[model samples]
Structure formats: structure tokens, C-alpha cells
Target: MSGEDFEDALKYTLQRKGWKLSTTKKTGDFGADLIGHDPKGRKVVIQAKRWNSKVGVDGVNQVIAAKAYYRADHAMLVTNQYLTNAAFELAKRTGVEVWSRKRLNAEIEANIPSKSNK
Candidate 1:
């Protein structure tokens, strides 16, 4: 998927997960593609990347900066690719959540209601 399409999917997924999401402008987003709050009202900033290679520290840093800029309580980097070891370490130290492709897919699956329970 394209970067824009990935971002849109993330926004919809977040909404399904009970977040009030808002997409940022195409340019000058300062690393944030979407910003919003959780059900508990804790602010969140998200940076979405659709890359084939491993995502690096630069992406993590951008999300961290965006969190600070938006005064968000939580920051997340959502990518369709895996994160580098260095990027993961940086995110752990900075309290930023890095959602790799696997993790994101799991989250999406978990949010889906089972028809058996319906």
C-alpha cells in the first residue's frame, strides 16, 4: 500500500479501537500523520510509515518530536515494516510504542468481534 493508504487504514483501525482520530495535513505534519485521544482521553500521536526496509531511528525520533509538539501523553510509530534494533531501543527509552507489521496485525485482529459471540 502507499503511505497515504496505510495512514488511512491506521486511522480507521484506531477508530475501531475506540480512539478519536484526526489525520494531519499532507505536508508540514512534523512527523505525525494522525493525532487523537484514547477512550480515557489520553492524547496520542501517531506516525505511519509504509516501507519495505526496516524502519530506522529517524522515524522514531520524528514521532517523539511530534508527541512533544502536540503535547500528547503517548506516541506511536506504526509501520508496515519492521523496526531496526536501534530504533526499537530508542523507542523503548523514549516511551514510544513501535507497532511492527506483525504487532499491528495482531491488534487489528484482536479488535474484531467474533461472530460466534454475536
Candidate 2:
């Protein structure tokens, strides 16, 4: 999928989970893609990536950098593909949440709004 589509899904999933979503539009920038607050007002920073292949440790490093740069209380990396072993290890070591496509889709599905009420 395209980067924009992945970003939209990430925002939708977060919003459904009671997080406020904000976006940043930039090219070749080092900032996180979105900033948000949880239902209890905890700070969050998100980086959405649309990679046709596996995401590596470099992606995790960038997320970590952005998290620190923004002073966010929590951080997540939402990607369209699975992360490499190195990437997962890095995220684990740094306490960053990595959402793969399958996991992300499950979150989205679980939180999907019922159409019956609308």
C-alpha cells in the first residue's frame, strides 16, 4: 500500500483506541509523523512507514530519535510490512512498540465502529 493509505489506517486505529491524532507533512524530515494523547492524557508519538519490504533497525533508530526529540511519553512505529529481526531487537531494547501489518489490522478490526448505530 501507499504511504498515505498506511498513515490513514494508523491514525484511524489510534483514534478508535481513544487517542487524538495529528499529522505532519514533510519530505526528507526527521520528525515523527503524528503526535497524540491517550484517553488519560499520556503523550504519544507515532512514525508511520510504508515499506514494500521488511523494515530494518534503521527505522527503529529513527523512531527512537524522534521520540526523544519530541520528549514523548510513548512511541510507536506503524509499518505496512514486518520488521526485520534486528529491528525487533532494537525496538525491544529501546521500549518502542512496533506494529506489523497483521497486528495493526487486528487492532483496526477490533476497534472498528459499528455501522448499525450510524
TM-score computed on alpha carbons, candidate 2: 0.88
Writing each residue's lDDT as its tens digit, candidate 1 over 72-95 gives 999999998899999999999999
Give the per-residue lDDT digits (tens) of candidate 2, residues 25-104. 66644558888787889787888889889999888888798888878898888887899999999999899988888987
Listed in order, each prediction's TM-score against the native is 0.91, 0.88
lDDT, each prediction: 0.92, 0.83
Backbone clashes in model 2, listed as residue pairs: none
The candidate 2 region of ten consecutive residues with least summed lDDT is 22-31
